[model samples]
Target: MGIKIGCCGFPVSRKKYYGEFNVVELQNTFYDLPSIDWAENLRSEAPGDFEFTIKAWQVITHPASSPTWKKMRRKPRGDTSNYGFLKPSNENLEALRETVRVAEALKSKIIVLQTPPSLPYSRESVEWVREFFSKASDIAQGFILGWEPRGEWSKARELYDIIEEFGIVHIVDPFRATPHLGKGGVVYFRLHGIGGSEVNYRYKYTDDDLKRLHEIVSKYSVDREVYVLFNNVYMFDDAARFKRLINS
Candidate 1:
């Protein structure tokens, strides 16, 4: 199967961006759980054929009251982890459940459980996550749960064991998650570039990076649905570039 290419709706105008790509990640939901009608409006903006996968609210994975913000360069870096969306409280879980409910209504395919870089792969975190999945999956219907690890944890195999056991997908960027490419199950590859992590803005994949990604996509085309997203948001034009790259 040919791998499907899309992007996270970061720096793009939905009206124009959705027309180019077949999928766009609803990342804003990671901060605040919006109403169903609002979510549907986003879906409506995209073509009828396009599919959307939303990131779960951050309260369960990234709680508030962190000191990293002052050290960061941007505001609302849209990190999701900096907010109190992942607190280990009833209210937080309830909010997560409601988000899942909405995604299910919209027939969304994946719910990203993106964890912060600081969240170590400890036994406690694993157990908590397992329990959260157990509860969330029940309410999520058939929506797949996926994750993107921020830091060095990307190289750890133990994290894969947990994710695999839970039957969750791993979201990876070539620069950060390249070392952890041996993972199985569903994989979401976000191709930024050979070394575009520094710019972190609108960027494009280098020719070499494109060749390597094309090879990887060909390698994994046998069975699994490979969801490849673009992250370089050049003044809200990243999705258009991704479309041109794939359709070229």
Candidate 2:
């Protein structure tokens, strides 16, 4: 069993980050696609044993109205609704294709699809995602696709069924919800800090929290490769602490 601990994005210089952890989930790719040259350069610089997981471009899951779209180099034209929301539109399909190219350039084995909290649960929405993934399956071969559905969709059984059907890994914040979908192989945990009704990005994990997290990972690590990525403000420190706690 193996547990790879890291942060959602780099919190320190590349050299320091590589020295501290064995994995990283690239957050830049979620906001906008980077050039293949940039991805190649990063891959070339990283240690051979280091692993990179990338967030799929927002254009595949978020609509134009999403604030994250403001950072994108290109904006959607007419009928912006068709551009994202996993509608199986041509525009979204092309965006996913571009994401695959970037992932390949970085030699990333995991591609995370994080939907906005606004995308609520519905039978129609479930069907749309099913169709979207089905259409893109060819491009997704040899990659571990992880879907982090937020809002009401995060609570739906239909969403879980779709994940199982598509062979998608369920990405979750263990502090929020334990993943009930997907078969065993790899478990991806994104910690966003437990707080009121939603994630508290400002909250830092305590030693007690780290211990509990270690217990959770140990349970899963019996037969799966677990990736515990901290997404809070203190992600770098928290991940380092958890790594020490788990290894001890």
Which number leads on lDDT? 2
lDDT, candidate 1, 1-248, per-residue tens: 56677766655566666656677777667656677888777667657788888877666666555553234342333445434423344555666677787786566978887767666666666666566666665666577877776654565656676565666677777555542333344568765544544236435555565666666766666766677777565423544544456567
Best model number under TM-score? 2
Kindly report which residue pairs in candidate 2 clash with one another.
none
- Global lDDT of each model? 0.63, 0.87
TM-score per prediction, in order, is 0.78, 0.96
Model 2, CA-based lDDT: 0.87
Error of 2 at 188 (Å): 0.4
User: Listing every candidate in turn, what is its Cα RMSD in Å to the true structure after a full C-alpha superposition?
Assistant: 5.2, 1.4
C-alpha lDDT (0 to 100) for residue 237 of candidate 1: 50
Q: How well is each residue in 1-248 modelled by candidate 2, as lDDT tens digits?
A: 78999999999998999999999999999886898999999999999999999999888898878888889886644467787778888888888888899999988889999888888567788788889889877778889889888888888778778788888899998888888647649999998898966588999999999988888888888889999999989999999988888767
TM-score of 1: 0.78
